[model samples]
Target: MELSHEYLTENREYKDYKDFVANCKLTKPENFNFAYDIVDRYAELAPEKRALVWIDDFDDEKIFTFTDISRESKRAAAWLKSKGIKKGDTVMLVLRRRYEWWILMPALHRIGAIVIPATDQLLQSDFEYRTNAADVKMIISYDNPHVQTEIEKAKVNSPSVQYLVTVGPDREGWVSFHGEYEKCEADFPRPEGEEKTYNDDPMLLYFTSGTSGYPKMVLQDFTYPIGHIMTAKYWHGVVDDGLHLTIAETGWAKSTWGKLYGQWICGTALFVYDMNMLKPDKMLQMIAKYGLTTFCAPPTVYRFLVRQDLSKYDLSLCQRFSTAGEALNGEVFNKWFEKTGKKIYEGYGQTESTIICGNFKDYSEIRPGSMGLPNPLYDVEVLDPDGKPVPRGEIGELCIHVEKERPIGLLMGYHKNKELTDAAFEGGVYHTGDNVTQDEDGYVWFVGRKDDIIKSSGYRISPFEVESVLQKHPAVMECAVTGVEDPKRGMAVKASIVLSQDYVDRDPKEMEVEISTFARENTAMYKVPRIYEFLKELPKTISGKIRRIAIREKDNKKEDK
Candidate 1:
C-alpha cells in the first residue's frame, strides 16, 4: 500500500478522471504535524529507505535515508532551541538547495516555529523589508559574499533579529550552523500541551514576488502538505520507489510543492542537484546520470531543453514529464514530445494554494496549450465581474469556492493584513485574479491575468496567446506581451522580446518585421503586436517570472516624455 493511504480516504488511484473528481477526499488528522507523523514514522518503519539524493557542482554527492534525516533534524532542533528559538517565533532560511535545508525544515516544523524560505538573491533593501515585516527572530543563511554583506547591513536596523547563523565556515559575529549542531545531542521529543502544533496553526509563510505592489505574507497552516497529494501522486505521476527531480530551489514555495512534502508522503526519493548556475546541457546530464524516473520543471526550462540536442542524452529512465509556473507553449510542448516520446503535463497553481488544476495521468486528456482540468480538491469556476460563473467558452476570473470550508492546503490569510484578506475573499469564493476560459469539455485555457488583458479596438487580447505564437519563432528567445498607450485605440498590443543569440546581431528593423510577419501568420491579426521592442532581456522577478507590469510602467514613462 502507498504511504499516503494513511492520510487519504482510500487508494489515490482511480480508473478514470470522473472517478477521482467524484470520490477523492483527504482525512485531516487533528493536531497534524508532517515532521513527526510522516518523517519520524517513516524512519521508525522503513529506516533504510532512500529519502534524498543530493549532488553539487563539484560532483560531490550525499545520499540520505529517512533514518538519517530524522537524526539530523533532531540535532538541528536541539541546537536551535538552545538559542531561544521557540514556538511562534519566525525564522527565515536562505539556504539555496543545500542539504541542510532538508535537515532544518523538519527541525523548524518539529518545534512549532514558522519557516519562511527566501532566495539568496535578495539585496539589503529586500532583506530590511522582510526582516522588519515578518519580525524575523533568526536567519539561517548560506554564506554567499553578497548575501552575507546584505544581511549584516539590514541587521543594524532590524530590531527583531537576535541571531545570525551561517551554514559554512565560521565567521565573526555569526554562529556556525554545523558547529552548533554537531555538539548538540540528537534528542528532541515532540512538544506537548500548549506547545504542540494543530491543523490550523501557521507552519509556513511566503512573501509574494511583489509584481504589482509590496510583497504580502502568504500564511499556510500545518495541513497544507496534505493537499499536494493530488500534485505528486496524480498530476506529477510520481511512481512507487521512484527518484523524482523537480528543478526548483528550496527558497521558493515550488520546492514544498515538488521537492518536499508530497513526494516524501508517497515514499519517493528526491534527487536534488545543487548547481551554481542552470545550463540546459548540465541539467540534462544530471537527469540521465541519476536515472531519474519522474521530472517536473517550468516552461522556461523546457524551452531551453528543446533547443539542445536531446538525442545525445539517455533519458529513457525518465518516463513522466510535467511543467508549471507558466503555461506551457505549444511549440515547446510539441518539440519535447516529439524528441522524448513523452507528453509534458501542464499544471496550474500559485503561492497561495497547491495544484488547483492539472493534467493528471489518468483522467485528463493532454491539451497542447491548456491548463487541463481542475483538481478534485478545489471547486474551480470562471466568474465574471459581477461574480457570476461565465459560460463554458468565455473568459472570466478563476475563483475557488471557500464559503463552505476553505480547502486544507489553501492559505489561512495574508498575515497581519485582514483588509487584504477580506478583499481576496470578498465573495463567498476566493478570487485567484487569474483569467481563464473553460471549454465545453471542461479543459481550462489560460488567458492572461486580470490586469494583463489588453483591450485593442473592440477585442480583449490575451498576452499568453500572442506570446505562444511568438515563441514559435526561432528569432525570439524570450518575450513579454503587454498593452501600451495608444490614443486612438486606448491600448495596443506591445511585445518586448529578447532575441536568440543567433539573431542578436541582425538588423533590429529587419528582425522586427520578420518576427511581426511570423506572429501575424501564426495568430489572429488583431492579436499581433502593434509595437515591438527588442531588449537584451525581459524584466523578471527574483523567481524568474516575467514582470509585464514593469514593461507597461516603462512604456507609460516614455509616453509622458
Candidate 2:
C-alpha cells in the first residue's frame, strides 16, 4: 500500500479533478516527523523496496532500498549528534546531486535539525549572508575547489558555523562525511517529549532566488510533506513502484518537490542523474537507459529537449511530464507534445509553497500556456490590491486565502523578518507577488510578476505572452522581457534575446526584424517589444532562471546616465 494513503483519505483514487478537490483530505498528525513516520515506516513494511537509483555522467551507479535509507540515515544521525548538532539547529547542505544529500536530509529530520539545502554555485558573499542570517550551526558540502575556497573565506566572518564537513576527499580541516558516518553505529532512536518534532516545528529553509532584492528565507514546518501528496500523486503522476525523475540539482526547492517527500510516500523509486553539465543528448540517453517512468523539469529544460532530434531517443518509458520554475511557452509545450505524444502539465509555485496550481493527471485539459487549475489545498484567487477577487477573465495578483487558517504547504513566514511576513500575509491572504488571469474554465494564465508587467500608452502588456511568441520564432533561443523607461510612454516593452546557435551569424538587424514581425503577427502590436537587443546570453540566477529584473536595472541605470 502507498504510504501516502496514511495521510490521505481512504478513497485515494478520484474520478476527476473536481472529485479530487471535493474528496481529497489530508490527516495531519500532531507530532509528525517525515523521517520517522514515512521513511522508517516504509523500511519496516517493505525493507527491500527500492528507494533511490543514483547515477552519474561517468556511468557509476548507487542503488538504495528502504532498509538502506533507514540504516544510513540513523548512522548519519549518530554522526551528526556526535558533532553536537541537535534539535532546531540550522545545517546547510551544499551537496549538489550527491547521494550523500539523500542520506543527510532524513538524518537531519530525524534529529529535528532544520536543513537548508543551498546551491553549490554560491560564492563567498552568498555563503556569508546565508550563514549569518540563518545562524547555521554546521555545513556539509561536496568538495568543489571553488566552493571550498569560498566557504573557507566566508567562515572567517560567519561565526555561527561551528562544524565543516565535506562529502568528497578529506580536506585539511573539514571532516569527511562518508568516512566518519560509515564508522558510526546506526542506533539513533526517535527522540521523546520536547526533543521530538511536532507538526508546526520548522523542518526546511530555502533562500529565495532574490530576483528583486536580497533573498528572503522561506521556512516550512513538518506538515509540509503532507501537502505534496497532491503534487506527486496528481500533478506529476508518479506511478507507484515506478522510477521517477525530476531534473533538478539537490540545492533547490524543486528537488524537494519531486525528489524527496511525496515521491517516496507514493512508493516510487527516485532516479537521480548527477550530471556535471546539462547536455540534452545525455539526459535523453539516461532516461532511455534507466527507463524512468515519470519526469518533471523546468520549461527551460523542455525548450532544450524539444530542440534536440528527439526522434533518435526512446522516451516511451517516461509516460508523464510536467514543468515549473518559470512560465511555459506555448510553442515549447506544443512541440514537446507533438514529439512525445504527451502533454507537459504546467504547474505554478514558489519557494514559499508547494504546487499552487497544476494540470493534474486524469483531469486537466492540458491548456498549452495556462498554469492549470488551482490546487485544492489552498483557496487560490486572482485578487485586486484591496484583496477582493477580480472577475473571471480579468488580470489581478494571484493570492492564496489564509483568512481562516494557514494551509499545510505554505511557508511559516519569512524567517526572522516579521515586517515582510506581516506585509505579505496582511488582508487575510498571502500575496504571491505574481499577476495572472483566470478564464471561465478556471484555468489560470500567467501574465507576469507584479513588477514584470510592461505598461505602454494605457495598455498593459504581459512579457510572458511576448516571450512565448518570440520563442516560436526560429531565430530566438532564450529571451527576457522587461519594461524600460520611455519618455513618450511611461514604460516601453523591451526584449533581450539570445539567438539560437543556428542563427548566431545571422545579421542582427535582419534577425530583429524577423523576430519582431513574428511577435507582431502572433500577438497584439503593443505587446511586441519596442526595443530589441541580441546577446550571447542573458543574465541568470544560479538555478538557471533568466534575470529580467537585472535587465530592468541595467536599463534604469542607462536612463539615469
Best candidate according to lDDT = 1
| Per-residue lDDT of candidate 2, residues 1-561 (tens digit) | 578888876545778878878877788988888889888998999988999999888889999998899999999999999999999999999999999898899999999999999999999999999999999999999989899999999999999999899999999889999899999999889998877888899999999886877899999999999888889988999988899999899888999999999899888999999999889899999889899999998988888889999989888988898899889988898888788888898998888999999998877578889999989888998999888889999999999999899998999999999999999898999999999999998999999888888889899888888889889997888999999988899999899999988999999999888888888888887788989999889998776788899999898899889
Clashes of 1: 0
Total clashing residue pairs per candidate? 0, 0
lDDT for residue 498 in candidate 2, whole number 0-100: 90
| Tens-digit per-residue lDDT, 174-228, candidate 1 | 9999987999998999999988888889999999885788888999999998888
- TM-scores across all candidates? 0.99, 0.99
Worst 10 residues of 1 by lDDT: 1-10
189: Cα error in model 1, Å? 0.9
lDDT of 2 at 449: 83
Computed on alpha carbons, the lDDT of every model, listed in order, comes to: 0.91, 0.90
